[model samples]
Target: MFFKLQSLALIFLGFNAYASPLAEPNEVHISERGAGLNSFLNLLLSYLPAIDTSVTDATGIITDFDNLLGALTGAQETYNELGRSCTEWTVIFARGTAEPGNVGVLVGPPLFDALDDKFGSSAITIQGVNDYSASVQGYLAGGDSNGSAEMARQIRAAKSQCPHTKLIASGYSQGCQIVHKAIAQLDSATASWISSVLLFGDPLKGQALNSVPSSRVFTACHALDDICKNGILIGPSHLTYAVDVVNAVNFAAAH
Candidate 1:
């Protein structure tokens, strides 16, 4: 169901509960990855000030919310496109990550460490340059010029590696901002090449995307997770994005 901003305040506080102990990363990459996405989305949904009951269906609720956000930002077309893409790509990536089932979490530091360990074995190629520091704040914090540029470079390179394949850029928390900035930087022609962007914990101001089309960006945030509650800047505002099936099921059960 669609939630009103006002009603969100009541259930929003519940998100802080999950912020407690860090859940052990799943040995299986698909599960761990999906957990990471849920963790972040829980945080997003909790921040909502209201819930719209008119959206009785799960997918409809998300679409209605996206439409609401799109109306506010005057980007309905983009938001609609992105909403569809996120749903489609979730299955594609989840399946791909499941095969190895050892890809590791997508969070910073710990996740990156695990990824490094995986890469050492040469299981996955070093698709992007390691030039940008994977710091929690500095460049990796997202939105920094260097970090965003580095991400663009990675996408361009990855695109070249598999020219025929669709490219999906998935990120968590601050990483989401970096991905968004990179996508924003792309020219209309180049941006179209992206198959999808799955943002696990998008915290950037969706309003900031006024210049770009929303259809290319797909954001997923936790309803009771608080990792991305506070932005690097300031203010008590929380970020919100569309949720995926794995997360939708989790939230439904929680409610």
Candidate 2:
């Protein structure tokens, strides 16, 4: 009886340890790295409207914001159609900081091409998020809740609506921060359903290093990428991830 009781106690202790939140990884300190003049400028830019309201149409009147709303709605409809057809795997991609409406240029074309080459076009589905400011301000000031919540919702929907399909979540730069936040909030079962997570030039790399098992998470940061440097000056390397996408896809395939 004592032996059986000891075994049960050990199992309970093990489960509790596994379920606890992990200690933060040792990395460059955000406070020391993320502060300074450049960081300030980046935050300021996030507050300014990306579009100029002063631009007028041929009728000499400013275009209504409703036009932008309509375009976004149309895009969502198109994405919904694609999502409905996804059979094998779904890749939810989040764009980098301050690059709204540019995920196609930044990571989509090459990443999707690689996936199609490996699994065929119809075997994969692509969903991209670019509406958020994804700026330094959003990351530092906790304004990423909306973006993280949207990401979490999509993940949950994919799991419930497509039970057999695999899920791969990829993000770049500040987008990586959002993905990390979303993943951290997921229930263990839903988190386990994610086959892989790929991050490129991740600014929040330190904070997220232990969120998942190292085997399921892959990260690539350029040696010169200042954004991933945890508060260093922004550099040209931050703008490129073509090679990383290919590598990430390869990792996903193998896993």
Candidate 3:
């Protein structure tokens, strides 16, 4: 009995050492990071008129939504262009924080390629966030709030339009916060359609983990990546996710 207790105590200590304060959902305060610049900018932006964000289509392309009529027209045009009716594709919406096109160029291609390779066809479309701003302000406020809302709207719209579509939500850094917020707001019916959630270097990893089921969620954080280890401290470590993308693809393929 004493030996058993000793073993258990050692296991507990090991677990604690491996865990970060970020492992606690409520322990890490996102608002407390970085002198409140993000929060202040968010407040300033609140006073301005709202802008149309973006929407995704069956082909996993994200288009700008200029207005109500424009968005509708754009969606229809995209659907038609992609030959929407004949082929079934799994949609993967990927968002990256602070970088203009890093998500598409860096993290998106590998995952998309993997999915295509595994499925033996171009079975996946990656819709990257176009309006993503790489600013400290945007990071704190969860990227663009309007953009995030629009993403949620598009997810619902796509699901309604294509009931057979499979959805995957993915993000990196502050983009993970956007994905988490958007997913949380999804209705049960829409959320149920989500097959997987992939997050890399997520700032709110612990809180985001609780928003979705463990079986459908996968995350990767580099050991030396301060952004994942801490929050939003930029370095070369946080910039790469080649291995993580491979793991994500494997996870998605299995599911």
Candidate 4:
């Protein structure tokens, strides 16, 4: 009986010694990144009104926003098994409207009515793809043309927090265009760290990405995605953004 009690005590001590918290320093770093990414959703909630007002016309925007939150937030769980993770950092490229007034889309439909009347039922075509980028530049850099430069600085900040970590930019429609410009302006050192870019229903002028590295660029187009292809004429039409990311992740894991 004395020997058995001693053995049980040893086992308990061993378990306590091995027990560690689920989150490590790297995990905390990645969590911060995820928080930054979620800030974009907050930006959307704050700025959706004064910029386009067209957001009110599309019900899909809300749905897509929810889906994006799920995908990004869930990325940690999905990547846990692989030991590869992300530190998501998302921010508003621009700011148009003030908060308080922009809050509550369902608070009686006054704002919704304004948006529907302005944008109408037809899908709004993205003509000036650079407009939002320009706005973002103004917001971040206090000027236009310097938006990409600002983005490079932001990437550097992220790198400082998480050294040699992979960066992925995923955007839909017009958002993709803004991300593309940000990628273009990135310095070579920063560019090398990019893992993949996932573009959904890209509508921006294809020429914006001309100088960007071809190997890293991928476009995901829906069959009926007339929205992105409307006015754009030429550019890389092959390879999809979503499939490329999945394949790239798998390849990296396997290797």
TM-score of each: 0.42, 0.64, 0.61, 0.38
Q: Highest TM-score, which number?
A: 2
Total backbone collisions for each predicted model: 29, 1, 1, 4
The model with the greater TM-score, 2 or 3, is 2
Per-residue lDDT tens digits for candidate 2, residues 8-125, read 4554454332222212213112222112222322322222122212111111110121122222222221133234854888988776554435353344444666677678878887
- In lDDT terms, how accurate is model 3? 0.50
Candidate 4 residue spans exceeding 4 A from truth = 1-56, 59-151, 205-212, 230-255
Which candidate number would show the highest lDDT if scored against the true structure?
2
* Candidate 3 Cα errors over 4 Å, as ranges: 1-88, 209-211
Write candidate 3's Cα lDDT for 1-255 as tens digits. Answer: 123556545544543332222222222122321222233222222221122122111011111111111221111111111224422555445445433343433345445545555564455544555445534566666566765675677667667666676667777666677677777778877876777788887776666442467789888776655566535454334444533565676787666
The order by descending lDDT is: 2, 3, 1, 4
| Every candidate's lDDT | 0.38, 0.57, 0.50, 0.34
Descending-TM-score candidate ranking: 2, 3, 1, 4
Every candidate's CA RMSD: 16.9, 21.3, 19.6, 20.6
Measured on C-alpha atoms, candidate 1 has an lDDT of 0.38
Please list the residue runs of candidate 1 whose C-alpha ends up more than 4 Å from where it truly belongs after superposition. Answer: 1-129, 139-142, 205-216, 224-255
